[model samples]
Target: MIRFVVKRLWNGALTLAALVTLTFFVMRLAPGGPFSKNRKLSPEVIANIEATYHLDEPLWMQFGRFVWGLLRLDLGPSTRFRDYSVGDIIASGLPYSLTIGFWAVIVATTVGIALGVAGALRRNGFTDYAAGTIGVIGIAIPIFVIGPVMQAVFALKLSWVPVGGWNDGWRSLILPVIVLSLPNIAYISRLTRTSMIETMRENYVRTARAKGIGEWRTIWRHTLKGTLLPVIAYLGPATAAIITGSILIETIFALPGIGRHFVDAALNRDYPLVMGITLLYGGLLILFNIATDLVRAWLDPRLRHDG
Candidate 1:
Protein backbone atom coordinates (compact mmCIF):
# COMPACT_ATOMS: atom_id res chain seq x y z
CA MET A 1 0.00 0.00 0.00
CA ILE A 2 2.82 2.40 0.74
CA ARG A 3 4.52 1.64 -2.55
CA PHE A 4 1.21 1.98 -4.42
CA VAL A 5 0.53 5.34 -2.80
CA VAL A 6 4.02 6.60 -3.58
CA LYS A 7 3.67 5.58 -7.25
CA ARG A 8 0.29 7.31 -7.53
CA LEU A 9 1.70 10.45 -5.91
CA TRP A 10 4.60 10.45 -8.36
CA ASN A 11 2.19 10.18 -11.30
CA GLY A 12 0.05 12.95 -9.85
CA ALA A 13 3.06 15.25 -9.56
CA LEU A 14 4.03 14.64 -13.17
CA THR A 15 0.48 15.30 -14.33
CA LEU A 16 0.43 18.58 -12.42
CA ALA A 17 3.74 19.60 -13.94
CA ALA A 18 2.45 18.93 -17.46
CA LEU A 19 -0.81 20.83 -16.75
CA VAL A 20 1.04 23.86 -15.41
CA THR A 21 3.39 23.91 -18.39
CA LEU A 22 0.51 23.74 -20.86
CA THR A 23 -1.51 26.45 -19.05
CA PHE A 24 1.38 28.89 -18.61
CA PHE A 25 2.25 28.82 -22.32
CA VAL A 26 -1.36 28.89 -23.50
CA MET A 27 -2.07 32.00 -21.43
CA ARG A 28 1.09 33.56 -22.82
CA LEU A 29 -0.09 32.82 -26.36
CA ALA A 30 -3.55 34.39 -25.98
CA PRO A 31 -3.91 37.29 -28.47
CA GLY A 32 -3.17 39.96 -25.91
CA GLY A 33 -0.43 40.14 -23.33
CA PRO A 34 -1.21 41.05 -19.72
CA PHE A 35 -0.68 44.72 -20.58
CA SER A 36 -2.79 44.91 -23.74
CA LYS A 37 -5.56 47.55 -23.57
CA ASN A 38 -7.74 49.78 -25.74
CA ARG A 39 -5.00 52.40 -25.78
CA LYS A 40 -1.63 50.94 -26.65
CA LEU A 41 1.15 51.31 -24.12
CA SER A 42 3.82 53.82 -25.21
CA PRO A 43 7.01 52.06 -26.43
CA GLU A 44 8.92 53.04 -23.27
CA VAL A 45 6.05 51.98 -20.99
CA ILE A 46 5.66 48.72 -22.93
CA ALA A 47 9.36 48.02 -22.63
CA ASN A 48 9.31 48.88 -18.93
CA ILE A 49 6.35 46.60 -18.14
CA GLU A 50 7.82 43.79 -20.20
CA ALA A 51 11.11 44.05 -18.36
CA THR A 52 9.37 44.28 -15.01
CA TYR A 53 7.48 40.98 -15.53
CA HIS A 54 10.50 39.46 -17.31
CA LEU A 55 8.29 39.24 -20.39
CA ASP A 56 11.14 40.90 -22.29
CA GLU A 57 13.00 37.60 -22.06
CA PRO A 58 12.62 34.90 -24.70
CA LEU A 59 9.43 32.81 -24.32
CA TRP A 60 11.31 29.65 -23.31
CA MET A 61 13.33 31.50 -20.67
CA GLN A 62 10.19 33.16 -19.26
CA PHE A 63 8.51 29.76 -19.17
CA GLY A 64 11.41 28.34 -17.21
CA ARG A 65 11.08 31.21 -14.75
CA PHE A 66 7.33 30.57 -14.45
CA VAL A 67 7.92 26.87 -13.67
CA TRP A 68 10.48 27.82 -11.06
CA GLY A 69 7.93 30.15 -9.44
CA LEU A 70 5.41 27.31 -9.41
CA LEU A 71 7.98 25.03 -7.79
CA ARG A 72 8.55 27.68 -5.11
CA LEU A 73 4.74 27.79 -4.59
CA ASP A 74 4.57 31.41 -5.69
CA LEU A 75 2.09 32.33 -8.40
CA GLY A 76 3.33 35.93 -8.58
CA PRO A 77 1.28 39.15 -8.41
CA SER A 78 -1.63 39.99 -10.66
CA THR A 79 -0.61 42.39 -13.40
CA ARG A 80 -4.06 43.97 -13.36
CA PHE A 81 -5.34 43.63 -9.79
CA ARG A 82 -2.78 45.87 -8.05
CA ASP A 83 -3.30 44.69 -4.52
CA TYR A 84 -3.48 40.93 -5.20
CA SER A 85 -1.20 38.05 -6.05
CA VAL A 86 -2.41 35.02 -8.04
CA GLY A 87 -2.52 32.90 -4.89
CA ASP A 88 -4.42 35.59 -3.01
CA ILE A 89 -7.08 35.84 -5.73
CA ILE A 90 -7.64 32.04 -5.66
CA ALA A 91 -7.67 31.90 -1.85
CA SER A 92 -10.40 34.54 -1.63
CA GLY A 93 -12.67 32.96 -4.25
CA LEU A 94 -12.40 29.26 -3.25
CA PRO A 95 -14.60 29.31 -0.13
CA TYR A 96 -17.69 30.59 -1.93
CA SER A 97 -17.31 28.03 -4.71
CA LEU A 98 -16.75 25.23 -2.20
CA THR A 99 -19.77 26.21 -0.07
CA ILE A 100 -22.26 25.98 -2.93
CA GLY A 101 -20.45 22.97 -4.42
CA PHE A 102 -20.74 20.86 -1.24
CA TRP A 103 -24.52 21.20 -0.98
CA ALA A 104 -24.87 20.53 -4.70
CA VAL A 105 -23.05 17.16 -4.54
CA ILE A 106 -24.96 16.10 -1.43
CA VAL A 107 -28.28 16.80 -3.13
CA ALA A 108 -27.21 14.96 -6.27
CA THR A 109 -25.79 11.81 -4.65
CA THR A 110 -28.46 11.26 -1.98
CA VAL A 111 -31.43 11.84 -4.28
CA GLY A 112 -29.91 9.94 -7.19
CA ILE A 113 -29.02 6.84 -5.18
CA ALA A 114 -32.40 6.65 -3.40
CA LEU A 115 -34.42 7.21 -6.55
CA GLY A 116 -32.33 4.76 -8.53
CA VAL A 117 -32.70 2.07 -5.90
CA ALA A 118 -36.45 2.65 -5.85
CA GLY A 119 -36.66 2.53 -9.63
CA ALA A 120 -34.82 -0.79 -9.74
CA LEU A 121 -36.83 -2.34 -6.91
CA ARG A 122 -40.14 -1.27 -8.39
CA ARG A 123 -39.17 -2.26 -11.99
CA ASN A 124 -42.08 -1.18 -14.26
CA GLY A 125 -44.26 0.10 -11.45
CA PHE A 126 -45.28 3.73 -10.79
CA THR A 127 -42.15 4.47 -8.76
CA ASP A 128 -39.93 3.25 -11.59
CA TYR A 129 -41.84 5.31 -14.17
CA ALA A 130 -41.79 8.41 -12.00
CA ALA A 131 -38.07 8.18 -11.30
CA GLY A 132 -37.32 7.63 -15.00
CA THR A 133 -39.48 10.55 -16.05
CA ILE A 134 -37.90 12.91 -13.54
CA GLY A 135 -34.43 11.74 -14.54
CA VAL A 136 -35.18 12.50 -18.20
CA ILE A 137 -36.43 15.97 -17.36
CA GLY A 138 -33.36 16.67 -15.29
CA ILE A 139 -31.08 15.58 -18.13
CA ALA A 140 -32.98 17.44 -20.85
CA ILE A 141 -33.02 20.83 -19.17
CA PRO A 142 -29.75 22.78 -19.36
CA ILE A 143 -28.37 24.71 -16.39
CA PHE A 144 -28.86 28.03 -18.20
CA VAL A 145 -32.58 27.33 -18.52
CA ILE A 146 -32.87 25.78 -15.06
CA GLY A 147 -31.18 28.74 -13.38
CA PRO A 148 -33.63 31.30 -14.77
CA VAL A 149 -36.72 29.15 -14.21
CA MET A 150 -35.64 28.58 -10.61
CA GLN A 151 -34.95 32.30 -10.12
CA ALA A 152 -38.31 33.11 -11.67
CA VAL A 153 -40.43 30.68 -9.69
CA PHE A 154 -38.65 30.48 -6.36
CA ALA A 155 -37.30 34.03 -6.13
CA LEU A 156 -39.51 36.22 -8.29
CA LYS A 157 -43.02 34.73 -8.30
CA LEU A 158 -43.17 33.08 -4.88
CA SER A 159 -40.44 35.16 -3.20
CA TRP A 160 -39.73 32.21 -0.94
CA VAL A 161 -36.02 32.67 -1.60
CA PRO A 162 -33.80 35.61 -2.45
CA VAL A 163 -32.57 35.78 -6.05
CA GLY A 164 -28.90 36.10 -5.03
CA GLY A 165 -26.21 36.94 -2.46
CA TRP A 166 -24.35 34.68 0.00
CA ASN A 167 -25.36 36.94 2.87
CA ASP A 168 -29.05 36.23 2.24
CA GLY A 169 -28.83 32.98 4.24
CA TRP A 170 -28.57 29.39 3.02
CA ARG A 171 -31.91 29.80 1.28
CA SER A 172 -30.01 31.74 -1.38
CA LEU A 173 -28.17 28.52 -2.28
CA ILE A 174 -31.13 26.12 -2.60
CA LEU A 175 -32.09 27.08 -6.14
CA PRO A 176 -28.52 27.22 -7.42
CA VAL A 177 -27.53 23.94 -5.79
CA ILE A 178 -30.62 22.18 -7.12
CA VAL A 179 -30.04 23.48 -10.61
CA LEU A 180 -26.36 22.51 -10.54
CA SER A 181 -26.95 19.00 -9.17
CA LEU A 182 -30.04 18.15 -11.21
CA PRO A 183 -28.25 16.85 -14.27
CA ASN A 184 -25.68 14.86 -12.35
CA ILE A 185 -28.39 13.33 -10.21
CA ALA A 186 -30.25 12.31 -13.33
CA TYR A 187 -27.17 10.61 -14.80
CA ILE A 188 -26.32 8.80 -11.59
CA SER A 189 -29.88 7.61 -11.12
CA ARG A 190 -29.82 5.98 -14.50
CA LEU A 191 -26.53 4.24 -13.71
CA THR A 192 -27.76 3.04 -10.35
CA ARG A 193 -30.97 1.68 -11.80
CA THR A 194 -29.14 -0.30 -14.45
CA SER A 195 -26.44 -1.54 -12.06
CA MET A 196 -28.99 -2.61 -9.44
CA ILE A 197 -31.15 -4.37 -12.01
CA GLU A 198 -28.20 -6.44 -13.21
CA THR A 199 -26.95 -7.16 -9.73
CA MET A 200 -30.40 -8.28 -8.63
CA ARG A 201 -30.57 -10.78 -11.50
CA GLU A 202 -27.26 -12.49 -10.73
CA ASN A 203 -27.16 -16.09 -9.39
CA TYR A 204 -25.62 -14.98 -6.11
CA VAL A 205 -28.66 -12.82 -5.49
CA ARG A 206 -30.87 -15.84 -6.22
CA THR A 207 -28.81 -17.93 -3.78
CA ALA A 208 -29.20 -15.21 -1.18
CA ARG A 209 -32.96 -15.26 -1.81
CA ALA A 210 -33.01 -19.09 -1.52
CA LYS A 211 -31.10 -18.85 1.76
CA GLY A 212 -33.90 -16.59 3.05
CA ILE A 213 -32.08 -13.28 3.12
CA GLY A 214 -34.62 -10.47 3.62
CA GLU A 215 -35.46 -8.55 0.44
CA TRP A 216 -34.11 -5.25 1.81
CA ARG A 217 -30.85 -6.78 3.04
CA THR A 218 -30.37 -8.73 -0.18
CA ILE A 219 -30.64 -5.53 -2.23
CA TRP A 220 -28.95 -3.19 0.23
CA ARG A 221 -25.90 -5.24 1.10
CA HIS A 222 -25.30 -8.11 -1.33
CA THR A 223 -26.52 -6.30 -4.46
CA LEU A 224 -25.19 -2.88 -3.54
CA LYS A 225 -21.60 -4.07 -3.23
CA GLY A 226 -21.18 -4.01 -7.02
CA THR A 227 -23.27 -0.89 -7.64
CA LEU A 228 -21.07 1.51 -5.65
CA LEU A 229 -18.03 1.05 -7.88
CA PRO A 230 -19.77 2.61 -10.89
CA VAL A 231 -21.07 5.45 -8.77
CA ILE A 232 -17.56 6.14 -7.44
CA ALA A 233 -16.15 6.09 -10.96
CA TYR A 234 -18.65 8.73 -12.03
CA LEU A 235 -17.89 10.88 -9.00
CA GLY A 236 -14.43 11.92 -10.20
CA PRO A 237 -15.91 14.00 -13.01
CA ALA A 238 -18.73 15.28 -10.82
CA THR A 239 -16.30 16.36 -8.12
CA ALA A 240 -14.06 18.29 -10.53
CA ALA A 241 -17.04 19.98 -12.17
CA ILE A 242 -18.68 21.04 -8.91
CA ILE A 243 -15.39 22.51 -7.75
CA THR A 244 -15.14 24.52 -10.98
CA GLY A 245 -18.57 25.90 -10.00
CA SER A 246 -21.14 26.40 -12.74
CA ILE A 247 -20.01 29.69 -14.22
CA LEU A 248 -23.41 30.26 -15.75
CA ILE A 249 -25.13 29.34 -12.50
CA GLU A 250 -22.92 31.70 -10.55
CA THR A 251 -23.56 34.48 -13.09
CA ILE A 252 -27.34 34.00 -13.12
CA PHE A 253 -27.40 34.08 -9.34
CA ALA A 254 -24.75 36.83 -9.03
CA LEU A 255 -22.79 34.63 -6.66
CA PRO A 256 -19.29 35.60 -5.64
CA GLY A 257 -17.42 32.45 -6.67
CA ILE A 258 -14.27 31.52 -8.57
CA GLY A 259 -16.37 30.83 -11.65
CA ARG A 260 -17.81 34.35 -11.70
CA HIS A 261 -14.47 35.86 -10.74
CA PHE A 262 -12.74 34.17 -13.68
CA VAL A 263 -15.52 35.27 -16.03
CA ASP A 264 -15.08 38.85 -14.87
CA ALA A 265 -11.34 38.47 -15.22
CA ALA A 266 -11.66 37.37 -18.86
CA LEU A 267 -13.79 40.40 -19.71
CA ASN A 268 -11.18 42.67 -18.14
CA ARG A 269 -8.19 40.80 -19.68
CA ASP A 270 -6.77 40.05 -16.26
CA TYR A 271 -4.04 37.59 -17.30
CA PRO A 272 -2.74 36.84 -13.82
CA LEU A 273 -6.24 36.15 -12.53
CA VAL A 274 -7.05 33.97 -15.53
CA MET A 275 -3.90 31.88 -15.17
CA GLY A 276 -4.38 31.64 -11.44
CA ILE A 277 -8.00 30.47 -11.75
CA THR A 278 -7.25 27.83 -14.37
CA LEU A 279 -4.25 26.57 -12.43
CA LEU A 280 -6.26 26.35 -9.24
CA TYR A 281 -8.99 24.44 -11.08
CA GLY A 282 -6.45 22.08 -12.64
CA GLY A 283 -4.87 21.45 -9.26
CA LEU A 284 -8.26 20.70 -7.70
CA LEU A 285 -9.10 18.34 -10.56
CA ILE A 286 -5.86 16.41 -10.01
CA LEU A 287 -6.51 16.14 -6.29
CA PHE A 288 -10.04 14.86 -6.89
CA ASN A 289 -8.81 12.31 -9.43
CA ILE A 290 -6.27 11.01 -6.94
CA ALA A 291 -9.00 10.74 -4.32
CA THR A 292 -11.26 8.83 -6.71
CA ASP A 293 -8.49 6.41 -7.56
CA LEU A 294 -7.90 5.74 -3.89
CA VAL A 295 -11.62 5.23 -3.32
CA ARG A 296 -11.95 2.80 -6.23
CA ALA A 297 -9.04 0.79 -4.94
CA TRP A 298 -10.50 0.68 -1.48
CA LEU A 299 -13.89 -0.48 -2.70
CA ASP A 300 -12.52 -3.31 -4.84
CA PRO A 301 -10.03 -5.73 -3.36
CA ARG A 302 -9.08 -6.98 -6.82
CA LEU A 303 -8.02 -3.47 -7.86
CA ARG A 304 -6.35 -2.73 -4.52
CA HIS A 305 -4.33 -5.96 -4.54
CA ASP A 306 -3.55 -5.83 -8.25
CA GLY A 307 -2.16 -2.28 -8.12
Candidate 2:
Protein backbone atom coordinates (compact mmCIF):
# COMPACT_ATOMS: atom_id res chain seq x y z
CA MET A 1 0.00 0.00 0.00
CA ILE A 2 2.82 2.42 0.87
CA ARG A 3 4.61 1.58 -2.35
CA PHE A 4 1.43 2.14 -4.32
CA VAL A 5 0.87 5.54 -2.72
CA VAL A 6 4.45 6.60 -3.33
CA LYS A 7 4.25 5.56 -6.95
CA ARG A 8 1.03 7.48 -7.46
CA LEU A 9 2.54 10.59 -5.81
CA TRP A 10 5.59 10.44 -8.07
CA ASN A 11 3.39 10.14 -11.15
CA GLY A 12 1.19 13.00 -9.98
CA ALA A 13 4.24 15.25 -9.52
CA LEU A 14 5.46 14.52 -13.05
CA THR A 15 1.97 15.14 -14.49
CA LEU A 16 1.76 18.51 -12.69
CA ALA A 17 5.16 19.54 -14.05
CA ALA A 18 4.17 18.66 -17.60
CA LEU A 19 0.85 20.51 -17.18
CA VAL A 20 2.70 23.64 -16.02
CA THR A 21 5.17 23.51 -18.89
CA LEU A 22 2.51 23.00 -21.55
CA THR A 23 0.17 25.67 -20.19
CA PHE A 24 3.02 28.19 -19.83
CA PHE A 25 4.14 27.93 -23.45
CA VAL A 26 0.65 27.67 -24.91
CA MET A 27 -0.59 30.78 -23.13
CA ARG A 28 2.49 32.72 -24.23
CA LEU A 29 2.11 31.56 -27.82
CA ALA A 30 -1.58 32.57 -27.98
CA PRO A 31 -2.34 35.52 -30.28
CA GLY A 32 -2.92 38.12 -27.59
CA GLY A 33 -0.89 39.40 -24.67
CA PRO A 34 -2.53 40.12 -21.31
CA PHE A 35 -2.77 43.80 -22.17
CA SER A 36 -3.91 43.23 -25.75
CA LYS A 37 -7.34 44.77 -25.08
CA ASN A 38 -5.77 48.10 -24.08
CA ARG A 39 -5.90 49.60 -27.58
CA LYS A 40 -5.12 53.18 -26.47
CA LEU A 41 -1.82 52.48 -24.69
CA SER A 42 1.31 53.97 -26.19
CA PRO A 43 4.19 51.72 -27.39
CA GLU A 44 6.48 52.68 -24.48
CA VAL A 45 3.68 52.17 -21.96
CA ILE A 46 3.01 48.72 -23.37
CA ALA A 47 6.71 47.90 -23.20
CA ASN A 48 6.86 49.00 -19.57
CA ILE A 49 3.83 46.84 -18.69
CA GLU A 50 5.35 43.86 -20.46
CA ALA A 51 8.67 44.39 -18.73
CA THR A 52 7.02 44.68 -15.33
CA TYR A 53 5.30 41.34 -15.78
CA HIS A 54 8.52 39.96 -17.30
CA LEU A 55 6.71 39.16 -20.57
CA ASP A 56 9.68 40.89 -22.16
CA GLU A 57 11.93 38.11 -20.86
CA PRO A 58 12.65 35.05 -23.01
CA LEU A 59 10.15 32.24 -22.59
CA TRP A 60 12.62 29.95 -20.86
CA MET A 61 13.67 32.66 -18.41
CA GLN A 62 10.03 33.41 -17.51
CA PHE A 63 9.29 29.71 -17.03
CA GLY A 64 12.31 29.36 -14.73
CA ARG A 65 11.14 32.30 -12.64
CA PHE A 66 7.61 30.92 -12.41
CA VAL A 67 8.93 27.46 -11.42
CA TRP A 68 11.12 29.02 -8.72
CA GLY A 69 8.14 30.90 -7.34
CA LEU A 70 6.13 27.69 -7.39
CA LEU A 71 8.82 25.92 -5.40
CA ARG A 72 8.42 28.57 -2.68
CA LEU A 73 4.60 28.25 -2.91
CA ASP A 74 4.18 31.71 -4.43
CA LEU A 75 1.74 31.86 -7.33
CA GLY A 76 2.87 35.42 -8.25
CA PRO A 77 0.72 38.45 -9.06
CA SER A 78 -2.20 38.73 -11.43
CA THR A 79 -1.51 40.85 -14.51
CA ARG A 80 -5.18 41.60 -15.06
CA PHE A 81 -6.25 42.21 -11.47
CA ARG A 82 -4.03 44.96 -10.14
CA ASP A 83 -2.25 44.46 -6.77
CA TYR A 84 -3.68 40.92 -6.35
CA SER A 85 -1.64 37.78 -6.31
CA VAL A 86 -3.00 34.57 -7.87
CA GLY A 87 -3.40 33.16 -4.38
CA ASP A 88 -5.30 36.25 -3.22
CA ILE A 89 -7.84 35.99 -6.03
CA ILE A 90 -8.32 32.27 -5.44
CA ALA A 91 -8.65 32.72 -1.69
CA SER A 92 -11.33 35.34 -2.16
CA GLY A 93 -13.48 33.06 -4.30
CA LEU A 94 -12.70 29.59 -2.94
CA PRO A 95 -15.13 29.63 -0.01
CA TYR A 96 -18.20 30.06 -2.17
CA SER A 97 -17.07 27.34 -4.54
CA LEU A 98 -16.22 24.93 -1.77
CA THR A 99 -19.54 25.47 0.00
CA ILE A 100 -21.63 24.84 -3.08
CA GLY A 101 -19.58 21.84 -4.17
CA PHE A 102 -19.52 20.20 -0.75
CA TRP A 103 -23.26 20.36 -0.16
CA ALA A 104 -24.03 19.34 -3.71
CA VAL A 105 -21.90 16.20 -3.38
CA ILE A 106 -23.34 15.25 -0.01
CA VAL A 107 -26.93 15.58 -1.16
CA ALA A 108 -26.29 13.84 -4.45
CA THR A 109 -24.48 10.90 -2.86
CA THR A 110 -26.99 10.30 -0.08
CA VAL A 111 -30.13 10.69 -2.14
CA GLY A 112 -28.66 8.90 -5.10
CA ILE A 113 -27.48 5.89 -3.14
CA ALA A 114 -30.82 5.56 -1.35
CA LEU A 115 -32.77 5.71 -4.57
CA GLY A 116 -30.41 3.24 -6.16
CA VAL A 117 -30.63 0.74 -3.33
CA ALA A 118 -34.39 1.03 -3.14
CA GLY A 119 -34.72 0.58 -6.89
CA ALA A 120 -32.40 -2.42 -6.94
CA LEU A 121 -34.23 -4.15 -4.10
CA ARG A 122 -37.63 -3.42 -5.62
CA ARG A 123 -36.89 -3.94 -9.28
CA ASN A 124 -39.78 -3.55 -11.76
CA GLY A 125 -41.73 -1.57 -9.18
CA PHE A 126 -42.73 2.11 -8.90
CA THR A 127 -39.55 3.15 -7.12
CA ASP A 128 -37.38 1.59 -9.82
CA TYR A 129 -39.42 3.28 -12.54
CA ALA A 130 -39.23 6.63 -10.79
CA ALA A 131 -35.47 6.37 -10.36
CA GLY A 132 -35.08 5.40 -14.00
CA THR A 133 -37.16 8.37 -15.14
CA ILE A 134 -35.09 10.76 -13.06
CA GLY A 135 -31.87 9.37 -14.48
CA VAL A 136 -33.16 9.85 -18.01
CA ILE A 137 -34.28 13.42 -17.47
CA GLY A 138 -31.06 14.43 -15.76
CA ILE A 139 -28.84 12.87 -18.41
CA ALA A 140 -30.91 14.25 -21.27
CA ILE A 141 -31.15 17.85 -20.13
CA PRO A 142 -28.11 20.08 -20.01
CA ILE A 143 -27.52 22.20 -16.89
CA PHE A 144 -27.68 25.48 -18.83
CA VAL A 145 -31.26 24.67 -19.67
CA ILE A 146 -32.02 23.21 -16.26
CA GLY A 147 -30.59 26.16 -14.32
CA PRO A 148 -32.74 28.83 -15.96
CA VAL A 149 -35.90 26.70 -15.84
CA MET A 150 -35.35 26.02 -12.16
CA GLN A 151 -34.61 29.67 -11.43
CA ALA A 152 -37.79 30.63 -13.24
CA VAL A 153 -40.04 28.23 -11.38
CA PHE A 154 -38.42 27.89 -7.96
CA ALA A 155 -37.05 31.41 -7.58
CA LEU A 156 -39.01 33.73 -9.87
CA LYS A 157 -42.46 32.19 -9.72
CA LEU A 158 -42.59 30.44 -6.36
CA SER A 159 -40.39 32.99 -4.58
CA TRP A 160 -39.02 30.07 -2.61
CA VAL A 161 -35.50 31.44 -2.95
CA PRO A 162 -33.80 34.53 -4.24
CA VAL A 163 -33.05 34.65 -7.95
CA GLY A 164 -29.33 34.91 -7.45
CA GLY A 165 -26.49 36.58 -5.55
CA TRP A 166 -24.74 35.34 -2.35
CA ASN A 167 -26.18 37.96 0.05
CA ASP A 168 -29.22 35.87 1.02
CA GLY A 169 -27.00 33.27 2.77
CA TRP A 170 -27.95 29.56 2.51
CA ARG A 171 -31.12 30.41 0.65
CA SER A 172 -28.90 31.81 -2.09
CA LEU A 173 -27.04 28.51 -2.32
CA ILE A 174 -30.16 26.36 -2.78
CA LEU A 175 -30.68 26.84 -6.52
CA PRO A 176 -27.07 26.47 -7.56
CA VAL A 177 -26.46 23.42 -5.43
CA ILE A 178 -29.53 21.65 -6.73
CA VAL A 179 -28.74 22.44 -10.34
CA LEU A 180 -25.14 21.32 -9.94
CA SER A 181 -26.04 18.06 -8.26
CA LEU A 182 -28.84 17.05 -10.58
CA PRO A 183 -26.70 15.39 -13.19
CA ASN A 184 -24.41 13.81 -10.63
CA ILE A 185 -27.40 12.36 -8.79
CA ALA A 186 -28.55 10.84 -12.03
CA TYR A 187 -25.16 9.32 -12.80
CA ILE A 188 -24.52 7.98 -9.36
CA SER A 189 -27.98 6.48 -8.99
CA ARG A 190 -27.73 4.73 -12.30
CA LEU A 191 -24.24 3.48 -11.59
CA THR A 192 -25.14 2.26 -8.12
CA ARG A 193 -28.32 0.57 -9.30
CA THR A 194 -26.49 -1.33 -11.98
CA SER A 195 -23.67 -2.35 -9.67
CA MET A 196 -26.14 -3.47 -7.01
CA ILE A 197 -28.02 -5.61 -9.48
CA GLU A 198 -24.78 -7.27 -10.63
CA THR A 199 -23.51 -7.82 -7.09
CA MET A 200 -26.83 -9.34 -6.00
CA ARG A 201 -26.36 -12.00 -8.66
CA GLU A 202 -22.79 -12.87 -7.61
CA ASN A 203 -22.26 -16.40 -6.18
CA TYR A 204 -21.24 -15.07 -2.75
CA VAL A 205 -24.48 -13.11 -2.47
CA ARG A 206 -26.44 -16.26 -3.35
CA THR A 207 -24.41 -18.28 -0.85
CA ALA A 208 -25.08 -15.76 1.91
CA ARG A 209 -28.80 -15.95 1.22
CA ALA A 210 -28.73 -19.76 1.04
CA LYS A 211 -27.20 -19.82 4.55
CA GLY A 212 -30.55 -18.42 5.82
CA ILE A 213 -29.26 -14.97 6.66
CA GLY A 214 -32.04 -12.41 6.99
CA GLU A 215 -32.78 -10.67 3.68
CA TRP A 216 -31.84 -7.16 4.92
CA ARG A 217 -28.87 -8.50 6.84
CA THR A 218 -27.56 -10.32 3.77
CA ILE A 219 -28.00 -7.15 1.75
CA TRP A 220 -26.32 -4.85 4.28
CA ARG A 221 -23.44 -7.19 5.05
CA HIS A 222 -22.90 -9.07 1.84
CA THR A 223 -24.18 -6.79 -0.93
CA LEU A 224 -23.71 -3.10 -0.17
CA LYS A 225 -19.91 -2.87 0.00
CA GLY A 226 -19.50 -4.48 -3.41
CA THR A 227 -22.28 -2.31 -4.82
CA LEU A 228 -20.50 0.85 -3.66
CA LEU A 229 -17.20 -0.05 -5.32
CA PRO A 230 -18.08 1.27 -8.76
CA VAL A 231 -19.80 4.29 -7.27
CA ILE A 232 -16.68 5.26 -5.34
CA ALA A 233 -14.57 4.85 -8.45
CA TYR A 234 -16.90 7.15 -10.37
CA LEU A 235 -16.82 9.79 -7.63
CA GLY A 236 -13.09 10.56 -7.74
CA PRO A 237 -13.03 12.67 -10.90
CA ALA A 238 -16.63 13.77 -10.35
CA THR A 239 -15.83 15.09 -6.89
CA ALA A 240 -12.77 16.92 -8.15
CA ALA A 241 -14.81 18.56 -10.90
CA ILE A 242 -17.59 19.84 -8.62
CA ILE A 243 -15.18 20.86 -5.83
CA THR A 244 -13.38 23.07 -8.33
CA GLY A 245 -16.79 24.66 -9.10
CA SER A 246 -19.08 24.58 -12.12
CA ILE A 247 -18.45 27.34 -14.62
CA LEU A 248 -21.99 27.44 -16.00
CA ILE A 249 -23.59 27.10 -12.57
CA GLU A 250 -21.53 30.00 -11.24
CA THR A 251 -22.34 32.17 -14.27
CA ILE A 252 -26.09 31.52 -14.33
CA PHE A 253 -26.56 31.89 -10.57
CA ALA A 254 -24.19 34.88 -10.19
CA LEU A 255 -22.08 33.14 -7.58
CA PRO A 256 -18.64 34.57 -6.96
CA GLY A 257 -16.21 31.68 -7.26
CA ILE A 258 -12.98 30.39 -8.74
CA GLY A 259 -14.92 29.11 -11.75
CA ARG A 260 -15.80 32.64 -12.81
CA HIS A 261 -12.25 33.82 -12.14
CA PHE A 262 -10.87 30.92 -14.16
CA VAL A 263 -12.89 31.90 -17.24
CA ASP A 264 -11.89 35.56 -17.02
CA ALA A 265 -8.23 34.70 -16.56
CA ALA A 266 -8.23 32.38 -19.55
CA LEU A 267 -10.02 34.91 -21.78
CA ASN A 268 -7.74 37.77 -20.75
CA ARG A 269 -4.66 35.54 -20.99
CA ASP A 270 -3.69 36.21 -17.38
CA TYR A 271 -0.79 33.79 -17.20
CA PRO A 272 -0.24 33.63 -13.47
CA LEU A 273 -3.90 33.33 -12.54
CA VAL A 274 -4.62 30.78 -15.24
CA MET A 275 -1.60 28.68 -14.41
CA GLY A 276 -2.34 28.79 -10.73
CA ILE A 277 -5.90 27.58 -11.16
CA THR A 278 -4.90 24.91 -13.65
CA LEU A 279 -2.24 23.55 -11.34
CA LEU A 280 -4.64 23.66 -8.42
CA TYR A 281 -7.29 21.73 -10.37
CA GLY A 282 -4.76 19.26 -11.73
CA GLY A 283 -3.40 18.60 -8.27
CA LEU A 284 -6.87 18.04 -6.86
CA LEU A 285 -7.73 15.61 -9.64
CA ILE A 286 -4.58 13.59 -9.06
CA LEU A 287 -5.15 13.47 -5.33
CA PHE A 288 -8.73 12.32 -5.79
CA ASN A 289 -7.67 9.59 -8.18
CA ILE A 290 -5.10 8.32 -5.69
CA ALA A 291 -7.64 8.40 -2.91
CA THR A 292 -10.04 6.41 -5.07
CA ASP A 293 -7.43 3.73 -5.63
CA LEU A 294 -6.71 3.48 -1.94
CA VAL A 295 -10.40 3.21 -1.16
CA ARG A 296 -10.97 0.49 -3.72
CA ALA A 297 -8.04 -1.45 -2.28
CA TRP A 298 -9.54 -1.20 1.18
CA LEU A 299 -13.00 -2.25 0.04
CA ASP A 300 -11.69 -5.20 -1.90
CA PRO A 301 -8.35 -6.60 -0.78
CA ARG A 302 -7.76 -8.07 -4.24
CA LEU A 303 -6.92 -4.56 -5.49
CA ARG A 304 -4.02 -4.21 -3.05
CA HIS A 305 -2.06 -6.90 -4.82
CA ASP A 306 -2.85 -5.41 -8.24
CA GLY A 307 -1.60 -2.05 -6.96
Best by TM-score: 2
Q: What's the number of clashes in each of the models?
A: 0, 0
The number of clashing residue pairs in model 1 is 0
Candidate 2's residue-wise lDDT over 167-235, tens digit each? Answer: 998999999999999998899999999999999999999999999989999999999999999999999
List runs of model 2 lying over 4 Å from the truth: none
lDDT of 1 by residue, 1-307 (tens): 8887888778878887787678777777778776777487689989988888888999899778777877798878888776889888778878888888989888899999889989998899998898898899899988888889888998999999988878778888888888888998899899899988988889999988998879888877788978878887888868887967768888888887778766777766666677677777777777777788788888777888765
RMSD of each: 2.0, 1.5
- Model 1 worst lDDT window (10 residues): 266-275
Model 2 superposed RMSD (Cα): 1.5
Note the Cα lDDT for every prediction shown.
Answer: 0.82, 0.92
| Reference-based TM-score of each model | 0.92, 0.95
Top candidate (lDDT): 2
The collision pairs in model 2 are none
